[model samples]
Target: MKTRKRLRSLGVNMIACLLSLIMLIPIVLILLNSFKTSQAASDMSLALPVGGLHFENYTLVIQKGKLGVTFFNSLLYSSGSVLLCVILSALAAYVLSRNRSRLHRFIYVFIVLGITMPINFVSLMKVMQLTLLQNTRIGIILLYTAIQLPFDVFLIYSFVGKIPRDIDEAAVIDGCTPLRLFYSVVLPLLKPVLVTVMVLTFLNTWNEFVLPLYFLGSSSMWPMTLAVYNFFGMYVTDWNLVSADIVLTVLPVVIVYLLGQKHIVAGMTAGAVKS
Candidate 1:
């Protein structure tokens, strides 16, 4: 029995390693090719560059890609969406979880259904046009917020259900208002899930290109993803510059995920056991 279990564990570990490599190989290739000369990187091989790294690829990418402006654009959109999504999701989840009424349940179900629903871009564009939000920073930010809200609400709703009601009662007994009860008391307890929501929302907003592509007509308002797309078009044959642009675009997401990785796991699993 012990031998059988050990073999099974080893097999699982091996499969996990294989999967990791499968996902990582492309990223490794891009990183390697980003440092090579344009001619060398053309093959997009895994082999290291023969000469010194072409560090200018990054500088050229930044200048030609308009990364400075697009980086700011991405940061603004992501930060705005993360802020709005976290606060609104947390509040909505708290209210719905605490109420437990049929209407609240219906609302929760309706919101969660969005997780699986396909977006109607036609209707979305019409509404954006009607609201005079097209091609604007706030419009893009709000669009990202709406896109991410459903999953954020669902994640927080589960986590909120796991918190004890006694804390709320005690806060009320202490003469705390509803806002105070939520903000001062319950909010702190939701740190793990909140962090999870923030990280997820930020990553989603940062990586999102479709919304910006459809809505942002102006190149000046484009995000990093759009910038990368434009850069790719201009330098289709210059693989090194393209790889460098891709690397820079992915760098922020990698750093953010690595920093919040532990919290993400903790938050997701915390609600599973029903403490």
Candidate 2:
């Protein structure tokens, strides 16, 4: 039995390793191809690097893409959106999970519909024009917040429902105000789900292109996604620089994902299994 179990474990490990490599192949190819000459990169070949350290493409991308500005813009939009969306969604989730009224149920359904329904850009454009938010960071942040709220609320709501109701009662008995109860007691308890919301929201905002393209007018406010899109146009044939740009764009997401991966897994499973 011991030998059999060992063999099974080894088999599983081998399979897992194979899967990891399979997923990693494209990324490896991209990195390798980025170092190759423009023609080689255009061919998308994975052969050993021929050209020694082709830094020109990277420099060209940096100079034209205004990578520093766009990187900062993406960071601001993603982080700001995450911050606002998570806080509001947490509060809304707690309330929705605890409430049993028809109105609350309707509101919950309406919010969740965002996940199912596609965004109507025309309506959004009109709203933005009305609010004078057509070309600003705050406007873009608010849009992201709205777009992310439904999923965040739903996830956090599900997670919050698992917490014991007795805790709320205890907090009230101690004369804690509703806001205080949430901030002091409930919010900390929802950390796992909150982290999940933050990471997911940040990723979505960071990678978004459509909304930014329509809403933001100034190149100064462009995110990495838009920058990458424009850069691709500028260097359509220069695959080395394009690949390098792709690497730069993806690197932060990889880092953020690795850092918050534990919380992401925990949050994904938090309220799913009753046991």
Question: Each model's TM-score?
Answer: 0.91, 0.88
Spell out the clash pairs found in candidate 2.
none
Give RMSD to native, each candidate.
2.7, 2.8
1-275 in candidate 1: lDDT tens per residue? Answer: 99999999999999999999999999999999999999999988999998899999999889988899999999999999999999999999999988978999999999988989999998999999999998889999998988888888988898888899998998899999999999999999999889899988888889989998899999999999888988899899999999999999999999998999987676556536755
**Number of the top-ranking candidate, with TM-score as the measure:** 1
lDDT of 2: 0.88
Q: 1-275 in candidate 2: lDDT tens per residue? A: 99999999999999999999999999998898777888878888778777586777677777777899999999999999999998899999999888989999899889988877798998989999999999999999999999889889888888888899999999999999999999999999998788889988888898898998899989899999899989889888987888889989999999988999987777667557874
Using alpha carbons, what is the TM-score of model 1?
0.91
Which one is best on lDDT? 1
By how many angstroms RMSD does model 2 differ from the true structure? Answer: 2.8
Model 2 lDDT-worst window of ten? 266-275
